[model samples]
Target: MPRAPRTRRSKYRALSSLALLALAAGAVTACSDNDSASDHSASSSAPSSASPGTGKVAKAKLHMVDNGGHRLAFYVTRGSASTIVLDSGGGEYSSQWKDIAPKLHTATGATVITYDRAGLGKSDVVPGPWKVESAVSDLKAGLGQLGVTKDVTLVSHSQAGEIANCLAKDNPEMLSGAVLVDANLPQFFTDEEIPRLVAATQPEVDAAKKDPEKPENRQLISTAEGFAAAHKAFHEVTWPNSVPATVLVSEKTPFAGSPEDAQRWRDAAASFAQEAPNRTLVTAKGTSHEVPTERPDVVLKAIEDMFAAQH
Candidate 1:
């Protein structure tokens, strides 16, 4: 095939670099584990409840919940018995799970929830550097106000993994299980690996700095501000042993272009699964870093299995 034009190639390269930067460095926000703010009152426009066996797809109700001063938007498809919360990757909106959330509700008869992070999608953006502690507090407060305080199956992708790890560690009783899809595991943020990731993504961070007014660039800059130190703290985070989890690692990991980094990614997933008896690792065969989009069947099956195990 003929090589693309210079502009096209540059655009593609920039996008690819941004994706990689978001994958590795976006979760590296710092705050004390106890830095989470208290839950704020959530105001819902509609009731988030639907009777199972109504012979119709459950309608998703939009709920805007306050997290300190700004609000996070959460969409809930009501069902009885269990709740499944789908968190998107960094630089991504909750709409990433639009096709899967309703299917999960239909297949498992569980209340399905999806939300935009602080700056993504319709959620109000809080100025300053991003903090995983604040992200955890947003989800916790949203669930609490929605009356989904227990029996939750948290399904997280990419950078959301950091939030999930902290949430599970701090509020173990609230979660019954988790399905992590091609997520950022703590094992990959070791002393040896963090510097390599930072070095690789620094160029994109520099590019983002030039056009910081763009939303994507702003997100990249904010998330990468404390990349090195934050990940050092992230490296110390551990998934709670009590919460059962199924980790889905894509066959073509986020670092597919780099064989060395790809191996480290795979090794991290395997190491995590090996550490806890309750943890399970499943490879999403013939898939890319976008596992949820590339292989929805694998993602759905893993989630359904985790949901079943919770009962």
Candidate 2:
């Protein structure tokens, strides 16, 4: 496979600078380490679970999965047709994908599944080591309990990117394709990357240690947790050798880097697509980190593109 349509070296240089600047701003201002900032992370309990609307909704049901007694909450959207699974971002529960799943179902006529992890949303939080293998297995079991088979396409965002990777790696045949939105992919996290992120978050950790629920502490954990959750294994999910997919990155929130940071998410995705049956990385122009909620149209189109290629 040819290297083909990659961004020019100059572009990478520019984006790289941008990345640095962003990181500097984040560092000085304490991007991920800010305890003062509020990052809305949903609680991992049934009492705090989001409700499914009764009026205009297409009648979805709440399904529970028993991962060796660890219960996870999931919404099953029964559209007039097909099946699609929506995966949320870091520190996010399935509740977050509520808006996007319905739109996808209405527009594309597919059943969509969105759920909370073991500790987020309605899922029961556990005290075990949350690794990548564990996360993938939970996802697979949830899908299995719902009877979602190999004919499904996964729509994953942010930290769930790792989960998507795990699924493709574990059960390649169970997926038709995937929709990756602003996910931290391309190797999960290298050794250098994780420590740097953790070190960068020291201020937040320090703040949080003083008060677990303190606002300052919450912000830092929110930042660090997003990065950490991606690598937390659920059920042996790994990246697949060939996944038909689209990667949607934010244009509003610049990749947390300097002016030199090459915002070549498209270039990277194009490179990844080399092995994918079909792939595209598009810009969600003027969108936030909350892409699925902020720009369902962008996600819908991307998924449509993936299915189009699959067909």
Best by lDDT: 1
Q: Write the per-residue lDDT of candidate 1 for residues 123-229, one digit (tens) a residue.
A: 98877666788788788878877888899999998888888888888889989999988888788887888778777777877887888876776777777766677
Report model 2's TM-score to 2 decimal places.
0.69
* Residue 106, model 2: Cα distance from true site in angstroms: 1.8
Candidate 1 TM-score over all chains jointly? 0.87
Q: Global lDDT of each model?
A: 0.77, 0.55
Model 2 lDDT tens row, 1-311: 11112332222222222121111111211111111111122222221122234345464567767776677777776653356888876555566665566666655656777887756666776543334445676777777666676767888876667567656765778888888887656532434344444555455445555765533233234334434334232212335656677777777433445222223444444555555545666778877555776777788788877755664
Give the Cα error of residue 234 in candidate 1, in Å.
0.9
User: What number of backbone clashes does candidate 2 have, counting pairs of residues 3 or more apart or in separate chains?
Assistant: 46
lDDT of 2: 0.55
**Candidate that would win on TM-score:** 1
Q: Tell how far residue 124 is off in model 2, in angstroms.
A: 0.6
Candidate 2 weakest lDDT stretch, 10 residues: 29-38
